[model samples]
Target: MIPPEVPLDDEELVTRAQAGDLEAYELLVARHTASAYRTAILLGAGADAEDMVQEAFVKGYRKLSRYRGDASFRSWLLAIVANETRNLHRSRDRRTGLVLRAARAAPYSEAAEDGAVDAALAGERRATLVQALRSLPERDREVIVCRYFLDLSEDETVAMLGWARGTVKSRTSRALVKLRGLLDVEELSRG
Candidate 1:
């Protein structure tokens, strides 16, 4: 049995999965699950992220026959996860709020060097940014999250959002401007 970490390329796993190799499919899921969850979370799926990721994997498995070899398997799987997250968002009527998990602090020595005041300031800044992000329209938020938070390439964003490349670029530019405005307003209100 080949070890899961043997670095079999996604294309190979996908081919095996297409041949009804369950372990190959499982490996694909294991590889992409974290990223899928993060994308769901950034899209505001909240507690439903886990379910969304699971559903995406199941759906992806069922639809493996339709998956062309053109796109990377991870991108294709993520597009399905994005769609699942969007569907859940629509059905739930956007009930859950966005939760921004704070970054883990550095080692104790490094954290001590940074000091309590700096950490508090950083936390407050992060909170403000999260609030601003939550205030944007869902479409804008989705573009911003895909482009920035998820760090997806333009092509990947296009695939995930089912938008044209030009559309992705335009939306990302517009969303950034809107986000900046929101953050500015927040700063002004604080002052």
Candidate 2:
């Protein structure tokens, strides 16, 4: 008896999804959900990040026929997530708090011996960075989050933002400058 072939790559899954394979589409959603959630959080969706990710996956699956297959499936999905997040933001009349929660500590770590001190310092730094990031204008924050927080490539950012390559580059540069200024001010205020 021959073993069933597994779809090893995103392209394979995407092709299957485009051909109306529900399992393939579900697998793609499982693979990309983390990234979608992270992008939603960075976009200030806050507690609604999970919902936005879910909605993005649903929208992507529904619009699968429109996918041109020029870019990676992850990029395409993230673009949907970004758009959903923006729509959520616009619909909410009140501003949602943008908070980057501290990462959970790993179990059975040597760092646990000094974890208290280390965690305090690390949390403080993370809080400061998150605060500075949240203070920037939405466009600047989006660029910074796409470039740094999400660790997306320039091309991916362009796809996600629906911006030209040159525009992504310029926006990223300007965003970084503004972020640095915000961080510097934060530092001076602390001292």
Candidate 3:
């Protein structure tokens, strides 16, 4: 069964999944499929995107026994999906051009996003924003995806990336600054 405090932090579910419990694995899929699909779509489009996500889940299932519980299962799965999607983008035969693709949705806008006030222009702005994200360096893009798209905190990002806290902080900050500059340029060109 899933936990009360944390939906995705069910140790029993994870153990069962690791032990080849198909039901438990299905529960995990039900819980995280939206995010996985969104991440895949952000990384690519069409059939290759779907294939990349399917491959990630398959890969995760195969390696479930190796899970050490050092990080949350969701974190581990996100890392796997991210890696698989990135690898899929890199494979020449796939020719998905995902490496130059952008996210499918914008980060949730709160009071902090006062600059993005154009509701009628949301979709186009978001597409433009996603395109800019695709142009960033791999490390920058990964940090952004992990931190924003996956809604993982800095510590979780560090765990996923195998980097120190300071390094994650520095890299994420630098990446956001670069992304902001890209957005500014995009905004200007649109004007």
Query: Who wins the lDDT comparison?
Result: 2
Give lDDT tens digits, candidate 3, residues 1-191.
Answer: 86577554557788988888899998987787777766666556435666777888888888989988888777677677777776766775454433234433335345424555564356566677668777787788778877886678886777667778898999999999999999999888878
TM-score leader: 2
lDDT measured at residue 79 in model 3 versus the true structure, 0 to 100 = 73
lDDT of 1 by residue, 5-30 (tens): 66889999999999999999998988
- State the lDDT at 81 in candidate 1: 88
How do the residues 39-110 of candidate 2 rate in per-residue lDDT, one tens digit apiece?
Answer: 887777777888999999989989999999778888889999989988887798755434453122112234
RMSD of each: 3.8, 3.2, 5.1
Model 1 local distance difference test score = 0.80
Count steric clashes of candidate 1: 0
What local lDDT does model 1 show for residue 147?
80
**lDDT-sorted candidate list, best first:** 2, 1, 3
Q: How many clashes does each candidate structure show, in the order listed?
A: 0, 0, 0
Off by over 4 Å in 3: 1-9, 93-120, 188-191
Supply candidate 3's per-residue lDDT for 56: 80
- Model 3 is weakest, by summed lDDT over 10 consecutive residues, at 97-106
lDDT of each: 0.80, 0.81, 0.72
How many backbone clashes can be found in candidate 3? 0
